[model samples]
Target: MIAIDNILVSDDVVREQFVCDLAKCKGGCCEDGDAGAPLEKGELDEINAIYDIVKPYLTPAGIKEIETRGRYQYDREFGWVTPTIEGKMCAYGYRDEKGVIKCGIEQAYYDGKTSWKKPISCHLYPIKISMTKEGEVVNYEPRETMCRPGCIQGKKLKVPVYVFLKEALIRKYGEDFYGVLEQVAGSYFAKAEKQNK
Candidate 1:
């Protein structure tokens, strides 16, 4: 587990243009919940404590997934991903009436209610957690591919960093992580500006 309370985004334009495709992309990562994510030792203990309280609503599968796949720390050699669960959607992933894949934990968090009794990894998406040898924490941006050409081209407009960092980014990674991420995003913006010029 890493203790990255901050991320340093290298570009402002990239950050502004970046809108996570929660509805459109529906990356499988969201479905798995925190169980599909890595955690630090203390973070796990905290999550388990929460799990003990919410065990009833949590599925046996969700618990199993978290236990089996829960990474205590980042394995740089393999990269920051867990082994994909064979042919299974994340325990928290379900289709709505319109047949849209939605995340259960995210819904709960936003609605101010408790979701499954599992690790916090299930709640966070797009933001990845990793640890360095000195135990420094690191967070990675989500990997999203361009979906609609119009959506890709539309991002040429400029907006404030606060929009992404203070709002969406904070909602996902907490204030600490966003602080560092904004720094990284700033650098990205500068480089993008240079390229554009």
Candidate 2:
């Protein structure tokens, strides 16, 4: 594990490669999970605040689910999460013209209708975060089947998971933290390369 401040980042985060191949996976992560995307407590308010603006970007089914179930729901396992469409796609998600599932909230953000992009959890996908008594534990947790394309693409492109998730990490931690992580990753890879020689 690489210790950055109080956070403990799993080695896989630096070793394993991953880049979301949305075209191939068709945004399966938004729909395949048992529950909606995990939400931080503060994000609940953000969702509620932006729901009206994001609504038009969503699908009819998603809008109905959100309207009926509320903007977000509580899950025993995941605590707060976006409501799912009949236990399938997320209520905040919609299928694009290409039939790929996409986050309505993100689309709204891209369109400049909202400042918030989406949930941090959604942005930090493939890297699950857990708050421990000591600090935050960050782990690489890509879905084996659904993330295969991304994994392959990452390896082919030689993009480590940390690099691929640089933006999200910076957003979650901060630029300073990301810079330290990059230094750690550089040392980690260099040592491995030397050992292989």
Candidate 3:
């Protein structure tokens, strides 16, 4: 436990860099190609709204499958991407002309139209949040997952995520929402480790 704490604390302190060469491969994180990513609250709303709009365009059975699927899970403790629909890539995942997996929502945002309404986890790529038990945030940290090139990198190099979450509250939501999210992230982090182990 002490070692885990130390690694977590120290890793959160120093930023790490990994440049993804998407040209070398199709989007590794696309659908079954890689683990999914965590979704943010606003993202959920955006996706659901898109679903309502797009469902009419899909086959009846396809719409049924989506509606019958279980409620999407959101782990608040440790940040983890939500599960993707079976037999499909991420709802917002797409391939560019060069066959790179591009984010639908991001493109939408860039085009000045209704974006895919993607999760914050997707928006704040390479950067993650962390929190502590007493309801205090730890800091923000740089995550090393490979992503498309030209993504934004931040200074403060790395900070404790939970700590940063708390800090972000003033800029976004109030304490009550962030407090609950901290617990969710903590739980998700634990679950991810157990699975990997």
Best by TM-score: 2
The lDDT per prediction is: 0.46, 0.92, 0.47
Q: What are the per-residue Cα lDDT tens digits for candidate 2 across 1-197?
A: 99998999999999999988999999999988879999999998998899889888988999898888888899998899999999989888888789899898999999999999999999999999998898999999999999999999999999999999998999999999999999999999899999999
- Candidate number with the higher TM-score (2 or 3): 2
Q: Over the stretch 62-135, how does candidate 3's per-residue lDDT look in tens digits?
A: 44544675224444553445445464566446667797776655566565565453565554433444554634
The alpha-carbon RMSD values of the candidates against the true structure, listed in the order shown, are: 6.6, 0.9, 11.2
Q: Candidate 2 deviates by what RMSD?
A: 0.9
The segments of candidate 2 whose C-alpha lies over 4 angstroms from its true place after superposition are: none
Residue 191, candidate 3: alpha-carbon lDDT:
83
Q: After superposition on all CA atoms, how large is the RMSD of candidate 3?
A: 11.2
Q: How does each model score on TM-score?
A: 0.50, 0.97, 0.46
Which scores higher on lDDT, 1 or 3?
3
Number of the top lDDT candidate: 2
Over 4 Å off, model 1:
1-16, 31-35, 52-87, 115-125, 133-141, 144-197
